[model samples]
Target chain A: MLWTVMPLEAVLDGSDSYEPEYFDVPWNDGGRLIVEKLNMDSARVVRLISGNANDYLDASIQPGTIIQYAPKNQASKQ
Target chain B: MTLSPRQRRSSSARRVRTTPHPALQEQPKTHTQEKEKGQDVLQNIQQLGQTNIPQQLSENGIHTITIIGQIEGHITLPPQNKTTKYEHIIPQLVAIEQNPKIQGLLVILNTVGGDVEAGLAIAEMIDTLTKPSVTLVLGGGHSIGVPIAVSSDYSFITETATMTIHPIRLTGLVIGVPQTYEYLDKMQDRVIKFVTSHSRITKEKFRQVMFCTNQLARDIGTVMVGKDAVDDGLIDEVGGLGQAIAKLQSLIKARESKGGSTDALDSDAP
Candidate 1:
């Protein structure tokens, strides 16, 4: 039950789809999230950001947050 | 004092009467003298091993600059961290560039990356060297290390070496705003531009791998192995120190043949 923030672009691109079984809550309005408080042994509260290319976003991802991704798109193969 | 045969025969009476000065007297060699010589040799070895003093190697024209651990910038990292300070590196680069005796520069990198600006500055210095230079990437050349590795005229990586191509990461307090995003975007562009311009990789290909989300488990970047790096046109070849030195020698030879002075010449001659 590890929770991670999925960027708005990932969700909008269809690479990461929201699922009821994985997350405890529905998608938030913001494109980014700010962690308000952190318990060394337990939990945290985060705020979300609205998805936009111009949105000021911190690119760094936390260590344990596994951002889920769909299989590679056939058109975007490297 | 004992007089020689010629002195004794010619001026025996005078020599026998006069007392020799202590400075002119010869002391007999003893076991302690031999032991002292041995101790001096050991002390010389100890001096060469310890005490970060720079000793000139036997007149070799090749200068080796190692970029080990983290490349530190303006801020001081914790004492426990192994950091290659930019202040130290910048001067060495200048010396290597200015010194005529240094005909070639060999840069060895095994960094996990550090400040983006520091790494780029080092890379730029290496890229702009007039002397032939070669880069050998040992261990891991991750993050900003990638740019330094490719900055040399030729680059090599061991079979087990790896390079991580990821977007620029910022630490400390970061403001979340469109301007921040724009700043990050421009910084990313700078890295991509430098890498693409120096290496064989296309900008599109570099960006693709840089932004790839499938490679790292929790991170959004790609880790390329030795031969994979060469295949992807990031590094020149998969080789170790021996190959790297050979390539450097060849480059130096080629440069010399093309009218570049292999030996230091007096530019100040009137």
Candidate 2:
């Protein structure tokens, strides 16, 4: 995931900002995908394979979806 | 094994007419008092730990809509029940999120909790809703209600509210060996994972409470008093809606003031 520090003014339209959800496709182009964990600025873009976003949106994926990586807690360690 | 739950201690008929408490007890024959009385109950929940109730929102130049019901699953649970109706509430939450005048949501919960998938779905909607959401546990918000309790921007529970944090269960099932136990273990992990992720509890403490052997008569979990819940960091606050709303306002203002999101980044979609 890409981690970048951008101001809130960049990504948010004040009225049009959408919280991270399963509908959004990862726009990662291999190098390193930016994970804007706290960027309220502009919408941080993640590179995805072509048509990934559309397919992800059309697919009935549940919200609050996650990609668990490193062990942040004990249960995850296993 | 599609087994029914142990016969409910309550009567079957009593379960059928599960009407909203206010609507059942007092119907506002007078148009003036109807809205006023509803507002009063909302205020009481809001000011639970306090002495006085606030005046009507109309007088204060605010408009509000309070959705008070149990969100069980697909099945229409007994009225007064709190099953997360994913289909019904998912859209309602979406609507509420989009409503501009609806400044905040005061979600008062009195639920036994139901369907993990459904329960978490409701909690997720509440969590993601653009409008501020505040959840208060009145009598009990147990089982899956735990997640809904914490889903709010801020949370509160009555001094008497009780919460049961048991491991997940799929009511009657066919299993004879350790494999069944293994499946249960894995299912419980998912519940714990969600609970800990949404609340202040760490995975270790959440597991301890979920599997706390010393607490229940026939279960593998701990029941928490409102105060105990806050002390253990399972819930955010221990007062009723008053504290809950105050906390929610603070959170909303905090977010509104500085547009910072505390979203954790993950990839595998739920």
Candidates' lDDT values, in order? 0.60, 0.50
CAPRI verdict (incorrect, acceptable, medium, high) for model 2: incorrect
Best by TM-score: 1
Estimate the lDDT of model 2.
Answer: 0.50
lDDT of 1 at B36: 45
Q: Write the per-residue lDDT of candidate 1 for residues B1-270, one digit (tens) a residue.
A: 222322111000111212322221222122146564454334333321211112232266777777766676754343233456675567567767766667788888888777788889999999998889999999888888988999999999999999988776544478988898898888888888999999999999999998899998868889999999999999999999999989998998998887666353453345
DockQ for each model: 0.01, 0.01
What residue pairs clash in candidate 1, if any at all?
Answer: A30-A49, A30-A50, A31-A49, A31-A50, A32-A49, A56-B177
Q: Kindly state the fnat score of candidate 1.
A: 0.00
User: Global CA lDDT of candidate 1, please?
Assistant: 0.60
Candidate 2 off by > 4 Å: A1-78, B1-70, B76-84, B177-179, B259-270
DockQ of 1: 0.01
- Those runs of model 1 whose alpha carbons end farther than 4 Å from true positions after fitting are A1-78, B1-56, B262-270
Query: Considering only chain B, what TM-score does candidate 2 achieve?
Result: 0.67
Which one is best on lDDT? 1
